[model samples]
Target: MTAPTRAAPAREWADAFAAASNEDPEIQAHGKYFTCTYLLDATERSYAIKMESGRVTEVTVDPGPLDVPYEFAIRATPETWRGFGEPVPPPMHHGIWAATFQRDMRLDGNILVLMQNLRCVTRQIELLRTVGSPV
Candidate 1:
């Protein structure tokens, strides 16, 4: 038999994030009414995730530019993202706060909004490890 196909990274992440957020009471509680469009800028490509009330409602891969406004963007090289996706990430790669300070991961725009939804966002990021393999 042929080998099984792996889901695309963006699709896998989106599905896993949605499921994880919906199942976690803390994520749901903290994210109530938290709606935003955020971009993930990987070294080779970019994606936009539309989160509505703590759920990842949509994930668009390689969306070059947008007419619609995005609340913020998070960027990191593919290597950095791969580090974060490890089952047990090293010191700086363990979380967004750490990564932002110690690595090349960046957060831009709407800092206030991002901080407001920090907990939910953290959990969503953590779900990266659960959903797909890093490129």
Candidate 2:
């Protein structure tokens, strides 16, 4: 039998992240009310991900200080982000809450928005295990 064909890998972290989030079944099924924009700040770089009804509308890379508008920001050191990039993150690196409380990670800006869309946000971020971290 011929070998199975696999789609070409994404060229960059942003591309991988977008592809992963956009094509996820969980996001599509439960994201009907998940609409928001947020920043994933890795200290080394930043990604502004905008979601509309559970779909990733846009993903801006390294936006200027005021170029892109986001409701909240998940900020962390590059070192901390590397831990998240792992396929199986270590104890303190497992989730946003864990890292935020245990590592050098911060959730800033409008926190209520983050909480409002917490479920989808959590699922989207969990995609990092498959898509890897942007840092």
Candidate 3:
């Protein structure tokens, strides 16, 4: 047999994330967090919501595409939180988990919403773990 064909890694990853976001029951029920993944390639950059639930909490800058092979690796933890960061955020509760992969770099497009989603997901997970609930 010949080698298995692969769609562009970035595109495939994006598609998978989109599908997950669309079909996730937990997200639909919780109505809270939101998370996204962005990929920058030669011609352009793409963004999509990967997961969402609670409210957004954190955002990390992506390493420039040139220096980083896949552009960025973003993680979010969503939780049910209604107020601002006055009391310290859940993701930050772990003591600043590097908002961006590379502090010196930034994404090419408007990713504020995606960033919020990531934080929401991460925070929610934290809440569940803290309460001894399966995430």
Candidate 4:
């Protein structure tokens, strides 16, 4: 039998996410004005992703509390995040809205920024299916 599959380490996940976001056709198509910074807090680890004009400029993995500033944050228990990292998530884990209401996921800070870049951010979150979770 084959070994169980595993998620990539935080740094590798970060790089893959950045590449995937930059290369995504949907993101590039509608993200012409999608500029923002947001945090993804997975309880055990966090990532600060900065997007500028449809491209991922930087991804700070496990940044300190004061190291990076973001307009919004999506947080969840690692278990909840694992649901998101699946190739095809089941039930409430399929999207942020469902997860927020059905699971332990939380949307914090300036949620307006999240709504402002809703399309791109949604696509970005789906990148987890490819890059997997960081923690």
Candidate 5:
């Protein structure tokens, strides 16, 4: 047998996500939080979020190359800086409220991305929290 090789690079996860959409009449009637599409801008060398309503709802990413489709647009908050000693907002927590936002509001996916980024940018703040300091 020959050596196993790596899998093909992902054109973009968005392609699969879009294909999974349920177009059933019943499913369509049910409201969703937000819809939007994204594209990789080779010129900008970054992914761009395109909104139908000037907003972004939810996005899920596994790993590797993935492309998301342009769909619905809903207002979504990316990352915001908080004071060191200040507590995080309830909406910011990945709890039921946030979950609702994810399901109903379509703000579910990309949570891990947000958390990972937060950890990177707020390392000092997190360290203080770990030490029993208010944050």
Candidate 6:
């Protein structure tokens, strides 16, 4: 199959994440603990992923401020995001914690929620490589 766009819309990423998560046993097992909307701010654009009982029920691209009450928000520069989306990301780009520690990504709002669902979030991010190509 042809590679996806370098900067594909958030809906695409969200859909990919949902599909990947559904197929991942780890995500499915741990996703039950996560049931909330999360915002992904790609600097230039934004999207929201809504998870219900460990399943991704909705993905909204360019969601307005009041569209969703996100439990948390993850923000990163487009450049940083491109790195994270690599099939085999380098150090500091391999995971959200690494990126956050390296100052490449930022987490805003309920940190506790993010921590509780770290595994699911990480898997979702890893799936990014499958759907998003380098810019």
Candidate that scores best on lDDT: 4
lDDT of 6 by residue, 1-135 (tens): 988667655556667767776787878888877788898888787778888878888878788889788999999988888888788887788888888898878999999988888888888888777767322
- lDDT tens digits, residues 20-135, model 3? 43454655555543333343222223332233343222221233535323323333321211111224444433322343332322344545643454444444334322222111
Candidate 6 — worst ten consecutive residues by lDDT sum? 126-135
State the lDDT of candidate 4 residue by residue for 4-121, as single tens digits. Answer: 7466778888899999999999999999988888999998889999999999999999999999999999999888888888899878887899999985889999998899899899
What is the Cα-based TM-score of model 5? 0.22
Q: Summing lDDT over every window of 10 consecutive residues in candidate 1, give the lowest-scoring window.
A: 5-14
Q: Which stretches of candidate 3 lie over 4 Å from their true place?
A: 1-8, 32-44, 48-96, 99-135
* Ranking, lDDT, top scorer first: 4, 2, 6, 1, 3, 5
- TM-score ranking of the models: 4, 2, 6, 1, 3, 5
Which residue runs of candidate 6 sit more than 4 Å off their true CA positions? 1-5, 133-135
Cα miss at 88, model 4 (Å)? 1.2
lDDT of each: 0.75, 0.83, 0.34, 0.89, 0.29, 0.80
Off by over 4 Å in 5: 1-9, 22-27, 31-96, 99-135
Residue 7 in candidate 5, Cα distance off native in Å: 11
Candidate 4 deviation (Cα RMSD): 2.5
Clashes (backbone N, CA, C under 3 Å), per candidate, total 0, 0, 26, 0, 15, 0
lDDT of 5 by residue, 1-135 (tens): 976522122334333323222322322333232234433222212233432222223333332244554332122222211121124433443232342344432333455432333322133223222222110
For residues 7-117, write the lDDT of model 2, one tens digit per residue.
222237788888888899988888898888899988768889989999988889888989989999999987787787778888898789999887589999999999988
Model 2: weakest 10-residue lDDT segment is: 2-11
Candidate number with greatest TM-score: 4
Per-model TM against the reference: 0.83, 0.88, 0.29, 0.93, 0.22, 0.86
Q: Which pairs of residues collide in model 2?
A: none
